[model samples]
Target chain A: MDVVLQQLRHTYAAPGLEARTVLMIDEWQATSGAQILLRGISGSGKTTLLNILAGLLPPTTGLVRCGGQSLYALPEDERDRLRATTIGYIFQMHHLAPTLSALENVEMPLVFGRKLNAGARRARAYELLDSVGLRDFHRHRPLQLSTGQRLRVAVARALAAQPALVLADEPTAALDAESSHAVMDLLQESCRRTGATLIVASHDPALATRFDRVVDLRNGALHEAETL
Target chain B: MYELKLAWRNLANRPVQTWVTLTVVALAVALAVTVIHLNEGLQRGIIRASDPFGVLVVGAQGSSQQLVLSTLLLQGLPVGNIDGHIFEELRDDPRVALAVPMAMGDNIGGARIVGTDEHFFDLRSSQQAAPAFQLAEGRIFAADFEAVLGSRAAVGLGLRIGDQFRPAHGVEPGLEGDEHAEVHTVVGILQPSGTPFDNAVLTTVNSVIAMHAEALAAPDASTTTDHAAGNDHAAADLVSAAETVSAAETVSAAETVSAAETVSAAETVSAAETVSAAETVSAAEAAHADDHAGDDSHAHASAGQVTAVLVAPVGFIEANQLWRDFYTGAEAQAVFPGRELGGLFDLLNQGQEILILVGYLAAVMAALTLFLAIYSATESRQHLLAILRGVGARRRTVMLVVLVETVLVAMLGALVGRLLGYGAAAAIAGEISRRSAIPVAIGWLPQVEPALWLLPLALGVLAGLLPAWQAYRVNVVEKLFPS
Candidate 1:
């Protein structure tokens, strides 16, 4: 079965600023395990499109079907609950609670998880931190860790709940060249191992080669679609 | 939980501010507590002082207040004598259990000298029904010439039993010589009764009589000595005249003196006559010098026609009849001691109430100062509150934390304040009472009724609620928000 999207469009307006309609994706169909990339330069509505798909924001006009449920059809709290449990987001700037350690940061998703035992939550958090290759740094807070280490911790936290789709927004933007390659490699390897679909929105050419297909947006509209 | 944790940390964070507020609250609460106790004690003391002597009596035309002052307080402008004959008559009555005649006026070293018979000691009483004057070392007066000293008088004058001290005959104290009378032996010293009588020197009825008699008679040897000392060379001339003149020649010279000299002497005589008629200067002087003398017999008789009597009937029925009879007969008034005391208390109670109200107001203002201190801390600790909220603490839990912390601080302040207040009162009570002449009593750690704690507790609750409410209103969502 395919997670479906048909005739998707969105309009955004800022006071005393011109309004714009974003033609995100029209009649797109993709299988559950298919990976996609949204390629865009700055201000091309990449994050905006991700927000709509994740149910963080409502679409002006759209029908999005995921696991046989309409994303926009539920109330705000229900939509939030669905997004929290079923979708994983990795933003450009990873927001880890400064007071909590690396392992605790990875445990964030499980905190909202259903009646899971403390042992289970702790074990999952440990497993994710280890998978992100920061097993020894589990007790270090975000400020104490390197930039790459913090991003890796954020990626581990995102996938801790085992969501079906992982949407990353420039996850390697803050890293050096070598750290960026390593983070992309870990993201692709982890997504492939879990069989979870990965969609990355980035201007970095390195990420284009990591994903199967890339779709580029120009001037709030789709300009090109390509299979790498 | 959230609020208490926040409150405790908040208070800890600003230790100086918390301490200052706590101190202010403590001091005020302590003051309030001490004042409340003192006022209550003073009221009780005054009431006790009032009822020591029973059934105070005065003239028919006199006010109850005047009667209280004249017969009991031994003060105020004096009225004409209530008749020594009537006094004698009253003493002779079969129904009369005890009669003590009080004659006042002369002051010795500024201390009042009361002249009365030995019955004055018998009639003397205390609020607790204890003997008002107990012999500390020796016996009461054995003869009319003997004297008894009050406790303070004995202590202040440095006199003991058997020590002789002269009783002055004039309104002025320390009037020495035969004009004043020789020092009488202090045969007895009365125990401290905490009454005005503590300062008085008790002499027999005769001593008072001798004092006034000296006033009417020629000047004696001591007065002559003092006058001689005061007039050095001038006195020697008088001594020579006394040596040279025969009794017959002196009499002839007195008869031939100038008309102006006679006129001036007549003026002095007229002034003396007016002075004697006022009764306080003369009779009080008489009463004070020798209390037992019969020289006031003529004056008492002349004043008897206008005087009224006080009769203490045996039972309630007789008492009621006496009141009715006095009111209806001869346009006289009879006042019950109990009712009069109540009226006096009622009048004085208003002033006492004002005093208490001011104290309460001061306490409230002090409490506000404490409240402000706590509130100021709450405002400064907003970030700390946010941190606590970010934890698993609930709003009510945070409120309780603030509540508990404030209550604890307030309680501490109250305890400290009370200790300070007690110490302050103890240190200065004597000077205050002596200077004011209002007769304040000093006691260490004066009794504080258990119920008084309610005031501090109430203040604590109020001071706590303000800070607790502030902590409760801390918005968790806003704290998590960037702005």
Candidate 2:
């Protein structure tokens, strides 16, 4: 399913600062089986546009259609249900449940959907962890593991549900150069294997080259190019 | 299910808050249990103290009420006395089945000396089924001037079968000879009855009569030199009443003659004429005597008299209606034992009502406290609740999980509290039984309440309801409003 943004605009206002339009994307289209990179410097609206595409934030003006569903037209509950079933989120911080082990955290969505008992859920979580090369540390909490290992666990958790759309915000930002490359490789490999569309928001042009398409965000506008 | 997990995790996350709330609930449960046990125990004690024998009949002149208050309840002394003639008429009446007559006003060696019949012994002693006035060591006295000792009296006076001791004339201290009617033998000892009767020295009515008769015979007996007084260096033999003659006997003889004309100057020293000492003799003796005459006059004098009777009905229904007719007739006062007991219970139950109120209030407060604890915890878990909702846990399921957790806590607290209460009851039951002279076998049975299981279970469910409702009504969409 292709994602469409027609005259999409987002604005931000603070207590004392001048109100600014953070994002303005018109006639933006990401066709089925296409990858898009949102590239921008800090405060250049890369995250805002990606968030709009992820259906986590609504545009101030105009329509946003993700996977052929008009998110804004549905009630809040319906929109949340659609987002949970279809979209996979990978935040910069991973936002894993602290109380659960890595395996339980990965299987959390299946448990919520009542699709698995505790034993089945744990088994599926283990398989996903093994796929992400975290079989040895599947039972470890996020705090017990290193930053790179935690990111790997986050990737396993995001892809466990096998969603149609995966959205990652700075997925490799916390890793060093080598770890960053490995994390990017794992994310790309998982998305390719599952045939899911991946949208990543980042400032790195090196990561942009690996995707099918790269779009740059400059002066609150999108251009058909990636900048180093 | 997720909300329950979150609740448990949050409880584990804050150990102090959880412990404080649990401690409050536990203590409240314990207090409730204690109050229930105390109220129940006191009620049982009252019921035990007032069973089997329901009504008491005493001398009408002396206030039948006072006799019950004093003899049965051990609260006061009688205000007047009834004579042997009246007592005999009542005892021989068709309605009278069993009568336990008691006499007061004497103390022997610091123990009460009771003048009563063998029936009094039977009335005071209760065994497994029948009474246990059957002698413990020896036979009960078959004649006057012979006595039976209570268990405590025998032990306290160091008296045994065949041992002799003088009765103290009144409830006052003295080994005076005037008080010593011929020294009475202890023929039997009564078995323990767990009552005030155990502390009394009992003698037949004739023995009490003989004591006063001998006091009349020898007014100078106390003046005689006690031969056993300087007997530390001598044998432990007591001087016989026949051998204790002294100069005081002359004065005593003169008074006896003046007191009785047959023993007066008209008769030959009355040596061969053994005194009959019956009613006719006593009335004639009073005519010749001054103080004896006053006693005779008092004994027979009755300006106001009521024909009193004690009726034991042939059947239960007849017994119940006996008092009703008396009430309707308005001329007589008839008391049914059970009705009197019910009245007594009514009077006593007023205090128990206060206890019940306080106990009910405590239970309500406990429920409210538990409600508050669960509600506050759920309120603070709004964010976690939202996360659980987003995870796909049903609202009803979340509420049910919370309810189950609360129910578990309540059940556990109730169990612990009940155990503690019973343990406390068992520990003190012995001392209480001893002091109050009540018989209770100490065992594992909790005497608090038979329905105690229901109390905690119901409370747990009740306390869980509010939080369960809150969990059910939680809105999931509020968490993702900005989306």
Cα RMSD to the true fold for all candidates:
13.4, 11.6
Per-model lDDT? 0.59, 0.58
Candidate 1: tens digits of C-alpha lDDT, residues B1-483? 223433554566568987887787777776665665465545454455545565535344456655554445444433333444555655565544454665553545544566565555554443346655677878876544356777777887788876655555333344443334333566788887666666677764434543433332333564444333323211122222222434443333222222213433444323222222222322223333232233333233222121223344445665566556556755445557667656766766676678668767866876787678767766765544543333223456556767776776777777887777666664454554342223446454324544455576677779778787998888643453322
lDDT of 2 by residue, B379-456 (tens): 766555554444434566667766865665666566776677666665565555443334333333354455466676
lDDT per residue (tens digit) for residues A1-228 in model 2: 578888888888769989899888777887765666877898887766765665556779989887787868877545555545566667666666666678877886676555567888788889989977889987787789888887888787777767677788788888788888887887788777777788888887679768878887888888888333
Say which docking band candidate 2 falls in. incorrect
Candidate 1 — number of clashing residue pairs? 23
Best prediction by DockQ: 2
| Model 1 chain B: ten consecutive residues of lowest lDDT | B232-241
What DockQ do the predictions score, one after another? 0.05, 0.17
Steric collisions counted per model: 23, 2
B425 Cα displacement, candidate 2 (Å): 6.1
Cα displacement (Å) at residue B409, model 2: 5.9
Best by TM-score: 2
